[model samples]
Target: RALAQRQARDERADAARLYGRIATAHTYAGRYGEAQRGWRAAAAGHRKNGDVAAAARALSELARVQEYAGRPEESLRTCQEAVEWAKRADDIRLQAALQLRLADTLEHLDDPEAARLHRAAAERILEEEPGDRDPEPEHGANACEIRSAPAEG
Candidate 1:
């Protein structure tokens, strides 16, 4: 009761995130229908809030759930829509990410040729993105420590 009241009071935008969280929980709980509905709701809410990234992310989640539910064709379509939303957001990294995902889903949908094309597109973007950008060195390294006993006199 108290928890429900608190949930009801959550900000609408934040509630979108909550819906995605609940979707994940429901999937883990083996509640396929509930998980999917939650993900769809999250996508809708984030879209309404003008958060293209969040909306695409939720659609991607929904795609994954549809795959888990044994609807690979639907998953493929859903993943393609996710990629579309990602493109609308103009996020290159997200584009590469979702292109890869949608490509894989197409593979499962028995469209290997389309999958290859999508994969090539993603690879082209990733390859072209770094041509002018300088690469950064790795941030951390493994250091070795040595202990020496006092030298014998």
Candidate 2:
């Protein structure tokens, strides 16, 4: 956290990335409040720095943190916002992943129909990929794998 704050004084984008790493650590430690604050700052900083894709990724993780904190309503809203950012970033894979995540949150909220729709949308997105497109890397199958930072010693 101190490192991220220090970086914030000079490099907004780098600070956002550092905050994201701290947020991931907080999430693993079950420190939901700190995790939420870190992720929100990461998302905001990324957005302000004109890194929409990074902001989308941060928002996606924030939604997961919200869900883990038992705030499904907030999770749903955050997921929706993440989806929009992903779209703006022109990252189809991330958008599809966010949709699937939104589906999971909907299911947790007892909205199975909505969940099903989101699942179908995600499937459709994947299916719509052109045959010539490059295949996703082995780890790319999981959205969380896309942005998760390596654990620091």
Pairs in steric clash, model 1: none
Instruction: List, residue by residue over 10-120, the lDDT tens digit for candidate 1.
Output: 667877888888899998897989999999999998998899978888888898888878887887788788878888987666676677777777777678899799889
**Tens digits of per-residue lDDT for model 2 on 1-153?**
566466757877788888899999999999999999999999998999999999999999999898888888998999899999999998877887888888888888889999899989987987785554446533554444332222234
Pick by lDDT: which candidate is best?
2
TM-score: which candidate is best? 2
In order of appearance, the predictions have TM-scores of: 0.78, 0.84
Q: lDDT score, residue 6, model 2?
A: 65
Candidate models: Cα lDDT each: 0.75, 0.83
Candidate 2 ranges beyond 4 A from true positions: 1-9, 131-138, 141-153
Model 2: lowest-lDDT 10 consecutive positions? 143-152
Cα deviation of 43, candidate 2, in Å: 0.2
